[model samples]
Target: MTRLPPVPWTARADLAELVAALGPGNLRWVGGAVRDTLLGQPVKDVDAATPLLPEEVQHRLAATGLRSVPTGIAHGTITAVLAEGPVEVTTLRRDVATDGRHATVAFATEWRDDAARRDFTINALYADPVTLEISDYFGGLADLADRRVRFIGDPAERIREDHLRILRYYRFQARFGAELDPAAEAACAELAPTLKGLSRERVAAELLNLLGLSDPASTVARMDKAGVLPIALPERTPDGISLLSQVIAWEQAHAIAPDPLRRLAALLPADVRLADGAAARLRLSTAQRKRLSKAAGRGGDDAMDARALAYRLGMAEALDQMALTGGDPAPIVGWTVPAFPLKGGAIIARGIQAGPDVARILRMAEDRWVAEGFPDAGRATQLLEASIADAKIA
Candidate 1:
C-alpha cells in the first residue's frame, strides 16, 4: 500500500496552525502542494480544501488571530496570511452548472464530489495534513505514476464544462512530459472552436504558461496539428512554426530564457500588421505590443547597429529583434553602447539656424557618429563643423 507522505508541520508552523485551527475534519492540503510533494518537485503555493463554509472559515481564522482575506469567497476560497506564506483554503465545491467559461459551483461536504469536478485526475489529489493520508479519488496517483494526463471521466463532458481545459490539457503535458490521452486529444479537437469565446486574458495566460515550459515547440506543434493553435492565433503560419523551432533551438543554444512573445513573433505571419492583429487578439498590453512590434518588424542588419539601437529602443527590444532574426544575443548584450557626443546646442552654435532642420541635421550627424563606430569628441566636432560648412553653402 502506498501511504500518503506526512507533511512537515514543524517546518511550516503557519500551515500547521491554519489546518489545526480549522480542525482535522475541515482542512486538508490539496492541489499542487500535494502533487508536487509526491513528485519530489519544489512546491510554491499551499492550497487547501475544506468542508467549512466561507463565513465559518472567516470566523475560525479570525478567532485564531490569523488574517483571512476573501480572495474568492463565492468560490469558497479564503487566503490566510501568515509568516510562512498565504495558504488558499477553499471549501469543497461541486459544479452546479458550467458554461464554457465559468462554473456555477455549490459548496460540498464530500471530497469525492470536489475531486470529480476537476479537469485532470492528477490535479484532483487531496491529502490530510494531520493524518498524513493521501486521497486519490479519480486514480490520480495511477495517472501520475504512469506519466499520462487523462481527463477525469468523459473527455467531451469535462471539456464542455470549460473550453480552456483544451489548452490546459496540453500545457499540463508540456510541464510533465506526459503523453496526451488519445480520447482527450480527440475531444479537445472537437471542442477547440469554443476557444474564441474565452476572454483574451485567459487565453493569453494559458498560452504563455505553456510556452514557458521545456520543449514547448513539440507541444505547440501538436496543438497546431489539433486545430487549437489556429483558433488562438489566427495569424499562425506553417513557415512561422518552422522558424519557431529554430528560434527555440537558438534560445537553447544561447541559454536564453523562454520568451513567449518572441516565440509568438516567430510563429506569426511575418508581417507587423498581422503581428498587431495577433497581439490585439491576445489583448497584450501597450508595452507588450511595442516589444512584439519591434521584434516582428521588417528585418534590419541589426548585427552592425544593435548597440546603437539598444539606446534608441531598449536593450531588451533590440536583443529580442536580434534573436528573432537569428542573430547571436551574446555579443549584443555585452556591447558597450556609447552616447552621442553632440547635443542640439552644439548644432545650434554651428550657425546652422535653430529649428527642426537643426534637429534633423544633428540626427543625421548622430547617425554618422553611430555608423563610424562612435568617433572621438575631436572627430565628432570636425564632422559637425564640416556639416555646418556644407549647410552655409546651401
Candidate 2:
C-alpha cells in the first residue's frame, strides 16, 4: 500500500471540507489529484468519485450552502463551489457504450468498476479524503512510481474504446511518463491513423494541449517520428522538426506565456500551406486566426524590429507570434510606435474630401511622420498638409 504526499494548497482545505461533509462511504478523492499528489506535481483540479448519485452530491453540497453547478449532470459530474474554489464531484461511472470519441456511461456504486473503465493506469488512482489513505484497484500506484502510463486494460482494446487515448498516451508520456513503454508506443502507432476519423476541432484541441505541455517540441518530434502528427496536423512538413524543437525550448524556458494559439503559431512554418478554411475548421477564434496568419507572415525572427511589427499586430498577438517562432521576445520591450495625431474627420476639415484621396494622403503623412522619428502633433499636422498638397500636384 503506497502512500501519496500531502495535498498542496490547491487540494488540502477543499478536500478536507468535502470529505467531512460527504463522509467516507459516499466519496473519495479520485484521478489526477491523486496521481499528481503522488508525483509531487501541483494538483490543478480536485475530482472526487462517489457512490452517491450526481443529484445526491448536489443536494449534499446545497445543504452546506455551497453553490453547485450541474456541469455534467448527464455524465454524473457536479461542480461544488467551495470557498477555496470549485471542486468537481462525479459519481462513479462505467462505460456502457463508446464510439471512440463520445461515450455512454452508467453511474456505478462500486469504485473498482469506475477505475476499470478509465483509460490509463496512472489516471485510475484514488485516495480516501479523510484518512488520506491511497487506493490502487489497478496497480496505478506502482505505475505512478515507475513513471509508466500503461492502459487499464489491453492497449489495443483501450485505443479502440477511445481513439483520443492514442494522443493522450503520447501527451502523458511527455508530461508524466518520460520513458516510453514499447507496447503502449506500438499500440499508439498502430491506432494513429484512426485519429483521422476524429473531428478537426477535437484533433486540434488535443494537439494544442500536447504542444502546451512541457518539452512540447520533443513530444512533437516523437509524434512526427511515429507518423502521428501528419494524421493530426497534415499541414506540417518533415522540415518542421527543427522549428518545433526550437519553439518548445523557447516556451519551456519562458513559462509566462502558455496559450495554445501562440504554441501553434510557433510550430507552424512560414511556407507551410494551410487547408482552405483551416482556422474555421479548427474552430479557432477570429483573433487567433489573425494572429497565426500574422505570425506565419513574420517568420521565426524575434528581432526588435520584428517585435515592433508584432506590437503593431497586438501585444497578445505579438507575444504569441514570438512563442510560435521559437524566439525570445523580451528584447521587444519599451517599443513604442507613434499613432496618427489627426483623425480622418480632422483631415476632412482641411478641405480633404471623403474619398480614396483622403486615405492616400493620410497614409503618406503617417509614413513621413514615422520616418522623421515620430514628431509632435504640430509637426504631424504640418506634414499631413504638405503630403496632401504634394498628392494634389501628383
Candidate 3:
C-alpha cells in the first residue's frame, strides 16, 4: 500500500458509507485526482471508478442516504453529493464509438479496458480509495514518473477514435507533458484539421484550459508546429509564440496567475478588430470577449503607464495588459492609483445643470487632471475651473 494524501470527503459518514456500499475492492479513485496526487499537486475534483454499472452505483449510493445525479448516465457516470463534496462515480468502461466530440461507451468490469480507452496514460491512473495504492494497467505510472504523455495504444487509432484528442494531447502537454511523443505528434499533425469538425464551444473550452497552464508557450508552439492552431483559429499564426514566451516569463517573475484571455490575446494580432473576430469564432462569453478586446487594445498603447492603466482598467486587466505588452510589472505590483478629485456633483456646483452638460464638464476635467500628472487640490480646482470656462465658451 502506498501512502497518499488523505481523500478529504472520506471523513464524512455519508461518503464513507457510499464507499463501503460499493463493496470491498470495487470503488477506486480515478483520473485527475489520482494523477495529480501522484505529482504532489492539489486535487480539485474527486472521481472514482467501480465495476458496478450506473444503476448499481446509484442504488448503492442511495442506500447510504446519498442522492445520485445521473450526470452522464448513458456513459455510466453518476455524481453523488455528500456534505463534503460531490464525487463522480463512473463504472469501468471502453469506448464503443466516437466522432471527435461524443463517445459511445459500454461498461466493462475490468479496469484495464477502461484505462485503455482514456486519452493519455497519465490520466488513466487509478488508486485505492483507502489504501492509496495505484492501479497502472498501461504503464501509466512509468509515464507519470517520466513526465511523458503517450496514447495508450496505436496513435492513429486513438486519434481516429476522437479528433479532439489531438487538442487534448496538446492541452496535457501544456500541463504535465515534459516533451512531445514522436508518434503522437505525427498522428496529431496528420489529423489536425479534423479539429474544426468539433463544436466551437468544446474547442474554445479546451483552448482556454490549455492557455491557463502556468506556462504553455512551448506546447502552443508545438500546436502551431503541427498545423493545428490555424485550423481552429483561422486568422491566428505561430508568430506570437515568442511574444507569449516573454509575457509568461514576466508573469512568473511577478507572481501572477495565468489569465487565459491575456495569453490568448498575446497569440492574436495586435488589432482589436482581429481579436474580436477570434473571440466570436471561439464563442467567448460576453465578459471574456470584452476583457480580451480591452486587453488587446490597450496592450500596445505606450502612453498608458502602469499607474494610469491600473486606475482606468483596474488591477487585473491592467496587469494583463502589462504582461501582454512585455512591460515591467514590478513598478505597478504594489502601487496604488491616485483618485481624481472632480465629479459630476462638483461640476453641478459650478453652476452647470445635473444633466449631460455636467457629465461632459466632469469628463473634461478628469481628462485634464489625468493629463496634468494627477494634480493636487489646487491644480484640480484650476483644471475644473478651466473646463467650466471652456464649456461656457462653447
Candidate 4:
C-alpha cells in the first residue's frame, strides 16, 4: 500500500478554526483541496461540504464578519470570504435529473450520498477540518496513489450526467493521470457526440483549461483522436493539429507568460473563419479577439518586416508568435516606428490642400519616411518634398 503524504498542519489549523467557528459536524473540507493535499499538489482553493443549506451557511458566515456570496445558491453553494482567503461551501446534493449538459440536484445530508453523485473518485475525497482525518467514501485515495482518474461509477453514467467530463477526462489525464482506463476511454468515445449539445462557452472554457495544463499538444491530439475536438471546434484545420505539438513545446520552454490573449493567439489558426466565429462564440475578451484577428491575418509572415511586426503586434506578442511557430524572432528588432512625422495637420501646413490630396500626400510622405529608414521629422519632410517634386515632373 502506498502511503499518502501528511497534510499541511498550518492549513489544517486554519480550516479547523473556521470549522470551529461554524461548529463541528456542520462542514468538512471537500473536493479538490482534499484530493490535491493527498497528491502533494499545492492547493489553490479550499472547499467545504456542509450539511447546512446555502442560506444556513450564508447566515453562519455573516456572523463571522466575513462576506458571503451566493455563487450557486440553487446548486447549494455559498462562497465565504475568510481573513486568509475565500472558501466555497456547498451543501450535499444528489442529482434528481440530468440532460448530459446540466444537472438538477436535490439537497442531501449523507456524505456518502454526496460522494456517490460526484463525477470522479479523486474529486470525492473529503477531510474533517477539525480532526484532519480524510473520509474517502469512494476509493479516491487509492486512485490518487495509483495516478488514475476513474469515474465514480459507470463511466457512461457519469458522462451522461455532464458531457463536459469528456474533455475534462483528458484534461485530468494530462495533469494527473499517467494512463487512461480502457473503460473510461471507451465511454468517452461513445459519448463524444453529446459534446455538441454543450454551449460553445462551456466547451471553450474546458478546452482552454485543458490547454493550460501540461503538454497540451499531446492532450489535444488525444482529444482529436478520440473525436472530441470536432464537436468543440469543427472548423479547426489539419495544420492546427500538426502545429499543436510544436506550439506546446514552445510554450513549455518559454515558462508561460500570464497573458491569456497571447496564449490564445498562439493556438489560433491563420484562417479567419476558423478563429473568428469560435472567438465570438466563446465570448473572449476584446483584447483576445483583436489578438486572434491579428494572428490570423498576419499568418507566418508575422515576423517578415519591421513595419508589419511593430504595426501588427507588440514586442512580447511578436516573441510569442515566433515561439509558437518555432522560429527565432530576434530578427524582428526593437526599433520604434518613428511616429509618422507628417500628420494631416502637418500636410495642410505644407500647403497640401485639405481635400483627398491631403490624405494622399500624407500617405506619400509616410512611405518616404519609412523608405528613408524612418528618419526624424525634418528629414522626412525633405524626402516628402523631393518625392512631390519628382511626381509633378512625371
Candidate 5:
C-alpha cells in the first residue's frame, strides 16, 4: 500500500474541513497534485476527485460555511476557495462523446472510469484523503518510476478524443520522460494534421508551455521530424531546430533564465511578416504580437551594442534579439536605460518654435544624446542648445 508522504497542502485545515464535509471516503486527491508529490516536486495546484455530483458537492460545501464556485459545473467541477488557495473538486467523469477538441462527459460512480478517460497513465494516479493510499488504475506507479509518459489506453484513440494531447505528449515527455514512447510518437506523427483543427489558443498555450522548459531543443527536433512542427508552427525554417539549439546553449552558458517567447522567436526566420502571421495564428496578446514582430531580427547595425539595441527596442525584446543573435546580454543585464532627458518642450524652450523644425531639432538632440552614450540631463541641455544653434545655422 503506497501512501502519500506527509505534505503541507494535505495538512491544511481548510482543505481538511472541506474534505470532511464532502465525506471521509468520497473524495480523494488526484491528478497533478498527487503525481508531483510522488515525484518530490512542489505541488502548485491541488485537485481532487469525488463520486458526488456537482450540485451535491456544492450543497456539502455550503453546509461547512465554505463558499463554492461552479467553476466548471457543466463538467462536474466546483472550486472551493480555501485559505491556502483554490482547490478544484470534480466528480468522477467518463467521456460520453469527444470531438478531438472538446468532450461531452457524464459523471461516473467508478473512479477507474475517470482515470481511464485521462490522457496519460502517470497522471491517473489517485490518493485517498484520509488513508493517503495511492490508487494506480493503469500501472501509473510503474510508469512514473520508469519516467515514461504512456497514454492510458490506445495512443491513437486517446489522441482522437482530444487533439491537444498531441502537443501535451511532447511537452510531458520533454519535461519528465527519459525517452519517447514509440506508439505515442507514431500516433502523434500520423495524426499531426488533426492538430490543425484545434483552436489556435489551445495550440499556443501548449506550445509555449513546451518552450518554457529548461531546454526543449531535442523535443522540438522530435516534433519537427514527426511532422508536428509544420502544422503547429508554420513560420519555422528548415534550420529552425539548429537556431533553437543555439539559443538554448546561449541561455544556459550565460546563466539566463529560459523564456518561452524568446525561444519561439528563435524557431522563426528573421522575417517580420512571418513572425506577425505566426503571432496572429497563435492568437497572442497584442503586446506579445508586437514583441514577436520586433524580435524577428535585429533592427540596426550588426555592430550595435546591447545598450543601443535596448534603447531602440524595450529591454525584454532587446534581450530576445541578443540571445537569438548569439550576443552577450551581460552588458545590459541590470542596466537601467537612462531617459533621453530632452523632450519637445525643452527643445522649444531653447528658442525653437513649435513646428516641424522643433520636432526635427528634438530628434537631432536625441540622436546626439544616444550617440554620446546617454549622458546626464546637464549634457542634454548643452546638446539641445547646440542643436538649436545648428538648426538656425542650417
Candidate 6:
C-alpha cells in the first residue's frame, strides 16, 4: 500500500498525455524514476513500463502527436520524446536467454514476470501513474527502506545474466547501500572476471560513473578488497586507494566539484606512460587522454608559480595536479594566465633580419618575458631591446 508522494515529474502534462495515449491501466511508472521518487532524491531520467507491445506503444504515441523513437526496439523499448525530456517507455519483457553480456528477451504481459527478470529488487518497484500505488512483487519496498541493494532473485544468476552488474553492484552500493548485502557482494567477487567480456566503452562508462559519485573512496576500497578492482582496472596499486581518499578530502575542503577523470588520475600511478595506456584501454576521447596524461606527473614542487604551471599545462589540468598533490589552489582560483606580449614580427621590426636571427631573438625575448613573470607590454619591449643587445654582442 505504499504510495509515491507528489513529485515534479509526475505533474508534467506531456507524461500524462503519453500515459493516457498508451491506455489508462496498461502503463505505470517503473524503475529508477519510481525508486528515486520514493527515496526523496532528485530523479534525472524518467522511465516507465507497459504490458503493451512496442509497436502498439509507438502507434498510440503517434496518434497523440507525440514523437516516438525506437531507441531499443529489440529490447521492447521505445523513447517518447516529450518537451520536458525523453521518457523511455518499454514493453514488459522476460529473458529468454542470457549470456552474461547480452540478453534475448520475449515480450510479456504480466508485470511480475517482467519485474522478476530485473537485476535488483529496489529497481523493480512500480507505481500506478494515477493513484500513485506501488506494486512490489519482490521485497523491494523493505529493501529500499533499508537502503540495501539486493539482487532480485539470485545474485549469481543475475550476474550471469549481465556481467556488467558486477560493476553496477558496487556503483549502486555506493549510491544507496547502508550495509553490503553479503550475497550480492560474494557473487560479484566470484564473477568479477566476466567483466572482461564487456565492451571497453561500457566498462569505461561504468567505472567513470562510479568515480563521479560523492565520496566513492570507501566503496572503491571495498571493491578492491573483494577482488573486483583488479579485474576492472589491473593497473591500480594498493596506495592508489589511499591517494584517492586524500584527493577527495582535498576537493571537499576547497569546495571544488568532484571530477571523475581527476579522481581516476589520482587512483593511478604517477607515470605518464601508464596514464596514456589506461586512457587508450578505456577508449577515452583525445582531449580526455591528454588531460589524464598531463595529470599523471607529480605536482607542487616544480618551483614554477601556479600561473606559470597553469600557462604551461592548461588550467584544468593544473588545478587537477595541484589538488592531487595536496597543493593550495588559492592562487590560481580566479587568476588568468596573461599571454606573452612580444611576437616574432615585433622582433623582425626591430631591425633584426627576418631570418633565423629573428626567430632566435624572439625566443630569447619570450624566455626572458616568461622568466621575469610575464611583465606588461612596455616591460616586454624593454626585455626585447635587452635581448637584441645580447644577440648583437653574441
The backbone clash count of each candidate, in order, is 0, 1, 0, 0, 0, 0
lDDT of each: 0.82, 0.75, 0.82, 0.74, 0.90, 0.89
For residues 212-300, write the lDDT of model 3, one tens digit per residue.
Answer: 98888888887887799878777674578887788888888888877877888788877778888889888999988888788768645
Considering only N, C-alpha and C atoms within 3 Å, which residue pairs clash in candidate 2? Answer: 266-324
Per-residue accuracy of model 1 over 28-104 as CA lDDT, tens digit each = 77888878788878788989899889899999999989998999997898999988789888999999999989999
Best candidate according to TM-score: 5
Error of 3 at 109 (Å): 2.2
CA RMSD of all predictions: 2.8, 3.2, 2.8, 4.0, 1.5, 2.2
* Alpha-carbon lDDT of model 2: 0.75
Could you say which candidate leads in lDDT?
A: 5
Clashing pairs in 4: none
Query: Which of 3 and 5 is ahead in lDDT?
Result: 5
lDDT of 1: 0.82
Worst 10 residues of 4 by lDDT: 1-10
**Candidate 6 residue-wise lDDT, 1-394, digit = tens:** 8999988888888888988898879899999999999999999998999999999999999998999999999888999999999999999999999999888899999999999998889999999999999999999999999999999988998999999999999999999999779999999989988988999889999999999999999999988998989888887877999999999999899888889999999888889999889989989999999999888876634787777778778788888888888888887888888888778889777666678898888888887887888889999999899989999833
The candidate, 2 or 3, that scores higher on TM-score is: 3
The residue pairs found clashing in candidate 3 are: none
Model 1: residues with Cα > 4 Å off, grouped in runs: 1-10, 334-354, 372-394
Q: Across residues 1-394, which tens digit of lDDT does each residue of candidate 2 receive?
A: 5666654653456656777677657887788888887778777777888999988887877787667899999999998888777788899999999888788999898899999999888888887765677888888877877888899889988888889898888888888886678888888888898897788777877877887776677777778788888788776656676766666667568655556666666556564236224566677777767766776766544444544554356766666566655556665545564466877777788776798888888888877776666689999999988988889732
Task: State the number of backbone clashes in model 5.
Answer: 0
